[model samples]
Target chain A: MSGTWINLLIDIIISLSLLTGTFFIFSASIGMLRFPDIYIRLHAVTKGSTLGIAGIMIGAFLFLYVEHGIVSGKLILGMIFVMVTSPISGHMISRAGYHNGVKLWDKSVRDDYAEAVKEKRKSIDN
Target chain B: MNLQIVINIIIALMWMFLSESYTFSTFLVGYLLGILLLFVLQRFIPDSFYMDRVIKVIKLIILFIKELTLSNIEIVKLVYKPKLDFEPGIFALPTELKSNWEITILANLISLTPGTLSIAVSEDNSKIYIHAIDIPDVVESINDIKETFEKAIMEVTR
Candidate 1:
């Protein structure tokens, strides 16, 4: 009787986590469609998706461990791999866009990077 | 560090063989015993215990996950807002990290967290160009990075 209760609890936790993960991924998709520029979109894709994947992986790992008593190493490793790589790809894409003169949203508050580059060029010229 | 791990593994294996139980629980118990033995014999060891570094690394990972979850919630709120009202911009953040790997980790952590995404590192590796989804004050943002991510990383690496 107690075992059934434990199983139900585990199932509830797993479903909650899976739903949370799907919500984050859905928000990321909305941000991609709604954000004004490339850099902002990268933020949505990288952070949202990374956390989403982590949530999903944790839920899966727990489900497998509790139900089948099988410790799958791949789920944990895959989560880590995605967390490490997602930001890197996002960084690269934004960096490329910036260098190629992709315009920021017109309402952007500042661009210290551009000013820093200009200052460096002036110092070199002198 | 390497020697300590080797000793620990050997102790675990010896315990498994002697007890005729090759299960993971037995190996874990043996590993804890090995750690205790090493702690008692610390005076004879050449270097510090490996567990200190492991604990610090684990702490760093915990901090990263905490920040990731908090920021993800913030992003979800922003995405659902009826009218977008954010000031996205690129700013240069000067960093104190010297080595390439440390800087890379710092940048990756920044990108994974809320509001900020690292776009580029300057030639001398002194500054990272960060694009933020919103920036009311650049100085405050810079200090936030320095205090949280930079300090945590220095604790682990140094």
Candidate 2:
């Protein structure tokens, strides 16, 4: 009875992890299509790609958790490491875009950051 | 506690778990070998000086989480809004915080936030240039960031 219950739990976790992976991929696809401009699209892709891959790997790991307990753990650690590092690299590219004055699509409208800069200057003057 | 030994133990345990076997011989070999590898690898790696600034590091992490959560919610709203309200522009937020470590943290926090991206950390490290989406009140946002986050970093690290 205990053996059957344990198997059921592992299977459920694996199924949930798969759902998580699918959601990430779906999000990435939507982001790639809907975001305006290369910069914003790039931003979406960067985040989406990292998260999507992590989710898929986690799902696979969970599925193998019963037979290979430690495998999932290492995969989780690797995913965390990638999650931390990949965005930094992606930002480097986005930063380059801003420096080059890449145009933003007007369809995307609320850029409050520009006024924020003026205020920062005012504070410095005071 | 010996850091080396601590690391070795972790490695050994990880190995035993990964292989999914509990043989005494396997555990003994893995434990010794991991310790040896760590000692050899430690010499090749140059340690950063900022390890001493634990408080600053902790503050940075807290700030990052706060920004991430807030920005996530903000972006979701923008995405779902009946009218698209996004004016993405590169704006520089000048900083008085001088520590290089803090500056790096600042850049990362910007990137981590959903609606904002850290574009550049000024060469002099005096300014952080970020591109914020639909920032309603700049000073308020900056103040909120500084008071709620940067101040903590300053307290601990500087």
Candidate 3:
């Protein structure tokens, strides 16, 4: 009887985490659509999706562990891989966009990078 | 560092074999015992114990997770807002991290947190160009990064 109750509790916890993870991913998609520019959209996709995936992975890990009584190393590894690589890819895309002169949103208040580049060029020429 | 890990693992395996149980809990108990043994004999160890670095690395991971969750909520709120009137811009942040790998980790951490994305690193590696979704105060944002991520990283590496 007690074992059945514990199992039911684990199921509830798993479902709650899975629901929260799905919500985060949904928010990422909405933010991607609504964000004004490529750079801002990257923020939504990278940060939101990273955390979203982490939540989902945690849920999956717990489910597998409780049901099968075995630890899944791959789930933990995949979580770490996503956490490490997402930012690198985001950085690459944004860096390329900036160098390619993709315009920022019209209301962007500063462009310190451009000024830094200009200063470097002037020093090289002099 | 590698030697310490190997010794610890050997100790764990010996414990499992002697107990005649190959379960994870048995291994974990043995590992803890090994750590205790190492801690008690730290005076003769060549350098700092590997567990010190392991604990620091774990602390850094926890800090990153906390920051990631907080910033994700902030992004969600910004996204669901009716109007997107926040200021977004690219700004330069000077970094005190000297090593290449350290700088890379810092940039990756910065990209993963808050409203900021690390767009580029300077040729000399002195500065990182970050593009932010919202920047109410530039100095405050810079200081925030310096205090949290940079400080935590310094603790881990140095």
- TM-scores, all candidates, are 0.91, 0.63, 0.90
Alpha carbon lDDT of each predicted model: 0.88, 0.64, 0.88
What are the per-residue Cα lDDT tens digits for candidate 1 across B33-84? 9999998997898799889899989998988888788789988888899998
Q: Which portions of model 3 miss their true places by more than 4 Å?
A: A68-70, A119-126, B16-27
- Residue B32 in model 2: lDDT: 74
- Please provide, for model 2 over A1-113, each residue's C-alpha lDDT reduced to its tens digit, 9 standing for 90 to 100: 99999998888887886776676666656766777776666555555555556667877887776766656477778877765775588678876675466766775444434
lDDT of 3 at B76: 90
**Top DockQ prediction, candidate number:** 3
Best by TM-score: 1
Give TM-score values for chain A, per-prediction: 0.88, 0.70, 0.89
For model 2, the local distance difference test gives 0.64
Residue B143, candidate 2: Cα error in Å is 3.1
Cα shift from native, residue B68, model 2 (Å): 5.1
DockQ for every prediction shown: 0.79, 0.25, 0.81
Give the docking tier of candidate 3.
high
State model 1's lDDT.
Answer: 0.88
Runs with alpha carbons beyond 4 Å of true place in candidate 1: A116-126, B23-25
